[model samples]
Target: MEKEATRKKYNISVEATLEVIGGKWKCVILCHLTHGRKRTSDLKRLMPSITQKMLTQQLRELEEDGVVNRIVYNQVPPRVEYELSEYGLSLESILNALCNWGETHIIKKYGDKYAVLEDSILNQ
Candidate 1:
């Protein structure tokens, strides 16, 4: 018989959710993946502020959490890409909600989201 994984206890339900997605870069990375599949270089180009090492670590962690799919292709060198898993798709609404709230907050504080938000894939 196969062993079932143990369930983790969380103080609040959101804590469980946060355990997987909470962090400086995970949400941002996941947000990027929401747009489409991206290679490591593509992700780096998309988020220039993140260091390559940190980006790699974040990708590994996301993959371990079963929210991101990493694909490797056999080629001259190697090719890799990442996209959200089916399970990860469940977070789309939440990501959109967070984005909408951020827009509102930026506008409230800065008088215009256009002035505060960066021009990125998400904006385009």
Candidate 2:
């Protein structure tokens, strides 16, 4: 398939991985989803820095890539929720490793004051 051929063109596994998750917000969104399913509003609240447009765009992309699931509820006011797909859940270890590396980098660059913040992010 064309998809298979495109994947083969990547020189390394990391390149392939990056293709799926490469963006300013994808990994951060994934990290938040790792906690549990979240409504659009909840995600926006959790990541106040992201604009609504960017969050919606990233979520749509993740859904298309089979890394996220979107659930809709019909009602007077529609409700939508997003969670990681099984394939997305498979990234848990990788996400944790990335988080750990970031924590280490922060500690190395700054100092211990930010270590507590890292712990909280890891716990979340």
Candidate 3:
């Protein structure tokens, strides 16, 4: 049955985790959220490379997966913020490891050339 097949598809712990957080941007979004609550605009500003549509879609998926909490406040123009749910916060260590691995990989692969560029961008 379709349901049975679906269940089997994510039976593995890694598969289950990936089902929720695997994507070009989901991990990155989660990493940023680990810092603190951020509005959609703030996320966009931090990651200018992502399109609004893609960002909205990824956030919606994260919310649906119960990994990200979306809070809305009544105000003149309406205010909304996103933060990691307790479940999402559980990913902190994993995200940190991934970030570390990425930095190491970049340094090893590109050496000082790309590291300086990345440093300048982060500094800016």
Candidate 4:
């Protein structure tokens, strides 16, 4: 019974974490937030296609999940910054591996140069 309870707890934690960073945009957002704290405007600039509403929704979800922290600075205009929590940073290696794999597998297949070119000035 104790072992079963332990397994259930593990499953819940794993599933919840995956749910937080599971989506395409979520992972990218998390990766960008890892760089530093950023405002909604900054994130929009980094990912031009992401709409304001979607960005807000995603940020809200991440904050709710305890994967992100929102710092609101007191001012005439609210200066809110979003940053990753320690739990979020734990996925950095996993995200980086995905990046490397995408470069080699996805990008390489249909990159500008269809044929693999040797490193030479002529190839430039």
Candidate 5:
């Protein structure tokens, strides 16, 4: 007979959501993906502060969580790209809300949203 897997419980509902998307880099990575598909190099360029090892680890974790899809293409050099899975697209509104709140906070403190934020494609 096959055994059934156990279901984990969370103290707060948000905690369960955080468990999958929580982290310093996960949201940033997902934000980039929301724009379009990106390879490891593209992501590194977008997020210059993240180390190669850390980026790999975070991507792997996201892939494992079923939020990110890894697409490997067979070519001369072998190319790989990452994109948000269907389920992951559901977080778009949440991410947008966080971004709006952050802009508000920055403007409130610095008197300008762009003052503290870097000029990137996502800034638009």
Candidate 6:
């Protein structure tokens, strides 16, 4: 009955959480937004490696998941700002723990120049 045990009905809630924050870039996005609201261009500026299209797509997913709030202003030049929602703020502890753990020991021990670039690659 290993199959039966392992194949229990999938829970939508768990899947939903994963859907929101499961991807390689979602957490990274959350990390940056945690500080304060930021304009779309500001995000791109800070993380120049991420393409605009991908950022838009991921932000859409995050907005759908109720993890982020996108505020648009009707100015002469349209402005958009992104900030984390209450649900997204819940990840603060988990994210902080990760940061602390990494800074305290992991980075010190590993000390690889490519460590930053290799985070998602090695994890996957």
Q: Model 6, range 1-124, lDDT digits (tens) per residue? A: 4576665455676775566688777887887787889899977776778999999999999998789999999997889999999988998887777656766675577776366544543332
User: Which is better, 2 or 6, measured by TM-score?
Assistant: 2
Which ranges of candidate 1 are over 4 A from the true structure?
1-7, 122-124
**Candidate 2 clash pair list:** none
In candidate 2, what are the lDDT values of residues 17-93, reduced to their tens digit? 99888888999999999999999998887777899999999999999999999999998699999999999999999
Which regions of candidate 3 fall more than 4 Å away from where they truly are?
Answer: 1-8, 113-124
- Per-candidate TM vs. native? 0.90, 0.85, 0.85, 0.74, 0.90, 0.73
| Model 6 residue 91 distance off true place after TM-score fit, in angstroms | 1.5
RMSD in order of candidates = 2.1, 2.8, 3.2, 7.4, 2.2, 7.8
| Tens digits of lDDT, candidate 3, 1-124 | 5576555544668988888899899998998899899999988887888999999999999999899999999997999999999999999999999988987887888885464444423532
What pairs collide in candidate 3? Answer: none
If candidate 5 were superposed on the true structure by all CA atoms, what would the RMSD be? 2.2
For model 6, the stretches where C-alpha displacement exceeds 4 angstroms are 1-16, 104-106, 112-124
Least lDDT summed over 10 consecutive residues: which range in candidate 5?
1-10
- Please report, in order, the local distance difference test score of every candidate based on alpha carbons: 0.89, 0.87, 0.87, 0.77, 0.89, 0.79
Query: Which stretches in model 5 have alpha-carbon errors above 4 Å?
Result: 1-6, 121-124
Clashing pairs in 1: none
| Model 2 CA deviation exceeding 4 Å by range | 1-8, 113-124
Task: Kindly report which residue pairs in candidate 4 clash with one another.
Answer: none
Question: Which lDDT tens digits does candidate 5 get at residues 13-104?
Answer: 99988998898999999988999899999999889899999999999999998999999998979999999999889999998888789889
Stronger candidate by lDDT (1 vs 6): 1
Residues forming the 10-long window of minimal summed lDDT in candidate 2: 113-122
TM-score of 3: 0.85
lDDT of 2: 0.87
Model 3 is weakest, by summed lDDT over 10 consecutive residues, at 115-124
